[model samples]
Target chain A: MTFFINSVYFGMVLTFVAYEIGLFCKKKIRLAIVNPVVIASLIVGAVLVLGKIDYETYSESVQYITYFLTPATVCLAIPLYRQIHLLKKYPLAIMGGVFSGVLTAMVSIYFIALIFGLTHEQYITLLPKSITTAIGMGISEKMGGIVTLTVVAISVTGITGTLSAEFMLKLFRIKNPVAKGLAIGTCSHALGTTKAMEMGEVEGAMSSLAIVLTGILTVIGVSIFANFIG
Target chain B: MKYLKQLAIVLIVSLLAELMAYLIPLPVAASVYGLVLMLIGLITHIIPLRLVEDVGDFLVENMGIMFVPPTVGIIACVDELKQMWIPLLVAGIFTTFLIMIITGLVTQALIKKTGGES
Candidate 1:
């Protein structure tokens, strides 16, 4: 009973606190690493680890909240809706770029893991890392990979994308927001998108565009490869 | 009636995607199939934006919080994963990092060629 109550409170509190903290950090630190979700996730994850609380009890208590995930995913249409203009304006270019990027990202990692002699399950676990954390975690679970490992991987990749993106843009002299956004969303997923949005409207739209394209491309690429390997 | 349609579409997409996964043997799973399926519906106009606009709008705004339960999965499987820490750690970081770099570079090049916006 206590666990149930604690779990509910924990979820609610984490969301509120994390969002506020994240917003505050964004205003104060232009650096992108201070994202609310990342900050909150780390702190909350740490607390969970240290709490000695059972995950089952906690999840069961807060399952009501978690169920919102599916609907939440469907909600991505909002941003896409706003950016339909971007899609309309540069449909061919955006799709072509994003699809190719998605292909390169997934195949490159899949092969590297393959060469590393990682098991099938391990490969599946990391397959969705370039996607958002929610989707990535779910795919990881289904593919028989560690969900926690996948989440952590998602966060790290997001942070890496957020932190290193500017350096990357400058290093490679990538000037276009669409290119930058698509690149980040394809490689880093949500975290990268967050940073891309911070850079500008064009970057944000392009990043959002990349998310859709890469998600589709990766799906196709993964399916094709799954056939060849199996 | 409206909510039911929304939920049903989500389910249909999930099943269709999963079926595709089974037949295609992709490393990815069915739910992801569901995501791609929806994306296609939007792209090809199989499902009009109005049909899912409200529901999809809701899903995106709250996408951040979706990982809570799954992250909670950490506690459930930590024991099994703990035993394989080295492999999981190495594979997780290396594969993720490699994908990030390659995807970033490739997408950058693609955008340049596509010639839309800078």
Candidate 2:
């Protein structure tokens, strides 16, 4: 048992198995809330807690997997490229929608944090919650927020967007696929983009484009917003 | 060989983006620079889409699994989360709804104003 746990592959194998199970559950359940990442995190997290294995050991091996995050994020460009034509047709509408969404996310989180009397660190952690994990993690770390909390916040935001996106779009009577895609992607990042994809081709493409643009916008926006709290 | 070449293109672009991040004095993440660089490269046909498309699709498709490790780190901060979960949950849900409606309506209105085909 000691030897197996100590092996470099322990964490990696555990993560893969848990993720596979999560994938299975997602397929079987077919619910927005049945997020594979959340399920896998719970499974792996439970193993660490129950086995009394320290986070250090788990993360050391897991670093191998995380190395792909950067390259994957860079590759987001491919989808954005494929969908670039949508930007041309409704450049003003798309850009306007994304910009306003980004602004609202930052501003709303700021006030909510203040209203709740959250600590400075907690506030900053939630600041980038609406962006994709790949970019949001870096922003959180740079701004002296708890990176783990930011990750959780981001996942929750994505899930919330995914679950509510359809209902909210209908409630607001927003029929434009472009508007729907941009809203979900901007507010919830990639996870919500998954829902956007399912909505239709136009929604999916616009949402993919929104993910890249929202990430870029948040990267630039966080620095300015961080000052409000400071 | 095909996959390796596609991956190599992505890696090189990522490396260049990292270098740019270090040198550029902006507070931006390396991933953003990498994304912008790749977008420009593709638009200009300097780095053809086929060079990176296959690997890119694979990575994006499987990106969710990669986050498992970092998210599991939540174990380390259970105390902070416990203390803040209510506020965190409130802010996350409320703001998500707010942003969605605002962005959606704004875009819809703008599309109508522009007389663009929706």
Model 2 misplacement above 4 A? A119-121, A134-138, A141-148, A194-201, A227-230
Model 1 agreement with the true structure over B8-92: per-residue lDDT tens digits? 7765665676577678744454444555567667778887777776666555545555554554455566666665556455544
* lDDT value for model 1: 0.61
- Evaluate candidate 1 and give its CAPRI docking class based on DockQ: acceptable
Q: How close is candidate 1 to the true structure, as a TM-score?
A: 0.70
Tens digits of per-residue lDDT for model 2, A130-207: 887867888898888888888878877887898788888999999998899889888988778767866876786677
Per-residue C-alpha lDDT of model 1 across residues A75-158, encoded as one tens digit per residue: 444455556677766666666666666665566556756666766666666666677665565566755666776776665566
* Docking quality (DockQ) for each candidate: 0.27, 0.64
Tens digit of per-residue lDDT, candidate 2, span B7-85: 9999999999999988986546687788889999999999999999899989877877877886687677778688789
Highest TM-score: give the candidate number.
Answer: 2
lDDT of each: 0.61, 0.85
- How far out, in Å, is residue A46 in model 2? 2.0
